[model samples]
Target: MTATAKPLPAGWTIRLHRVHNLTVLTLHDEHGTDREIGFCPLTPDGPQDLTVSALDTIAHPRLREAAQNVVTSFYDRTAAARHHRDAFDRAVPDCRVLLGHLRARLPGCRADLGTDPNELTVTLTLTATTRAAGPLHALLARWPGHTGHGGSLADGIDQDLDSSGALTAALRQDRATEFLIWYRGQC
Candidate 1:
C-alpha cells in the first residue's frame, strides 16, 4: 500500500510582490482559500492621472446629507453670533473632548483643533479615502450643539493664538464640515 502526505493546518498568510512600481498582494487562508489584490503607481490617462483612486468603493449619500443637516441644525439652534462666540471661549477643553469622541466613534475621520479664550476651531478631515462615509458622517451628524460657537460648524480652519501672547493660549474656533463632506464625495 502507498502512503499519502498530510495537508497543512488552517491559517492565513499575506505575501507581497512588486514590479515596476506596481504592488501585488496575495492572501491565503488555511481553509484552502486564496485571493490576490494589486496596485499600480502609474496610469495611462490625462492630467487626472496624477491622482490615485481608492481601492474600495463607497456609497453613502444619505449619510453625507445627514451630516450636512446636523451642521446646519447646530448653527440654527445657537443664539446670536456674539453669544455663540462666548460659549466657544468657555468650551476650549470641551472641543478636545468632542474630538476624542469623534475619533472613537468615526474610524475614518480625524480632527485637528486650535483654541484660545477668544477663539476656537476644529477641522475634521477624512483619513480613509476608500471606506464608506457612513460611520464618519453619522458621527458628525450627531455632533452635540453644546460644543460652543468656537466648536460650531461655521468656524473655519485657521490656528489662532490666545490672550497670553502664547500660541497655546489663543482662542480661535473654525469648523470644516463642508470640507469633510466634499472629500467624502470625491471619486
Candidate 2:
C-alpha cells in the first residue's frame, strides 16, 4: 500500500485522485482506515473544485469564529465583577486592623466610618475624624473616582468613597472605629 500521509484533523485526508474521469476524495484515520468521501466529475479543461466543511470532515457543524463570544463575554464580565466583589468582601475586615493601627499611630484621633451596600455597588463614608494630625489630614483625600464632601469634622462629613479607597485611607490614618456590621435580613 502507499506510505501513510502526514497528520490531519480527524476523518480528513489528502485524498484526491482521477478515477473513471472523476475526481474522488477519501478520508483516513490514525489507523490508516479510509473510505471514499465523494466523487465529482472533472472539468473538461482542469480539475473540479472540492468544497469541504468541518460539518463533513469532523462530523459536527463548524462554529462561527465568534460563536462563543456572547457566552464568553458574559462569563468574563461576571467573573471579574464577582472576583472584585469577593476581594472587597475580604478587604472589609482588614480595615478594622488598619483602624487600630491608625488610632494608635495618629495623634488624638477618633473615627467613624459608615458603609452602605445597595445591590451593585458598596458606598463608604468617613463620617467622623477628630484632632487628626495635620500631615494625616490628606490621608482620606478624595481622588478623581471618589465622591467627596468638603467639610470639617464638626460638620460631620458624609463623603462617599469606594470601600477599597476608604480602606486605603483608613490604613494611612491608622484609626479604627466600631462598625455594626449585622445585615438586617431581607424584608
Candidate 3:
C-alpha cells in the first residue's frame, strides 16, 4: 500500500523546508518560516530558541534534568529528534500534573495545554486577573515555573512581579493576564 501524507492536527499546521542543507519540518505556520516551532537537525541555528523556550516552562526539576541529560546523547538529526520527542512526552504528563496543581492552588485561573509538531514540545498558558492583592501576588510568584528565568508574559509586561502585580491603572484595570509556559523535548 502506498503511504499517504498524514493530515495536520486540529489547530496545527506543518510544512517541509530546507534550511542550512538539512530537511526540517516547519510546524504551525504555512508562511515565511519565521517563528519555527520544531526542527529535525537540532543544529546550532535550527530553532534552538524556541526549544529552550519550551524547556523553560517545565515545573518538574526532574523532567528538566532529564532533558539536560539527553542534550549531548544524540549524534544525528533523527536520533536527536527522537530524544527531543521523548523528553516532550515525559514532560506532557508532568505539565498536566502541574496544571492540576495550579488549578487547585490558585482559584479563578484558567489553564490551556497544547503541543507542536511531532509532539516535541508543549505550551501551557495560565490566565488570571487581579481583583485583590492576594491573588495578584500569587499569580506572579507562580509564574516562569522552574525554568522561566528569561521568559516573560505579555511582551515583558509581567517581568517585574512587584510592578506588574499591582493593578493600579486603567490598563491594569482590565486585570486579565496570561502566562504562557512552553516545554520542549521529543515526543
Query: For model 1, how does the per-residue alpha-carbon lDDT over 82-109 read when each residue is reduced to its tens digit?
Result: 4655645464434455556555665654
- TM-scores, in order shown? 0.25, 0.25, 0.30
Candidates' C-alpha lDDT: 0.36, 0.36, 0.39
Candidate 1: list runs displaced more than 4 Å: 1-89, 114-128, 142-187
Q: Write the per-residue lDDT of candidate 3 for residues 1-187, one digit (tens) a residue.
A: 0122123333433343446644343444234433333334433333322323233343435433333333222223335456654655553436565566666666655555433344334344345545344663455555444224464343323322245453321111011122323221211
Scored by lDDT, model 3 comes in at 0.39
Best TM-score among the predictions, by candidate number: 3
Q: What lDDT does candidate 2 reach at residue 133?
A: 38
lDDT of 1 at 79: 31
- TM match of model 1 to true structure: 0.25
For model 1, what is the C-alpha lDDT against the true structure?
A: 0.36
The local lDDT score (0 to 100) that residue 117 gets in candidate 1 is: 26
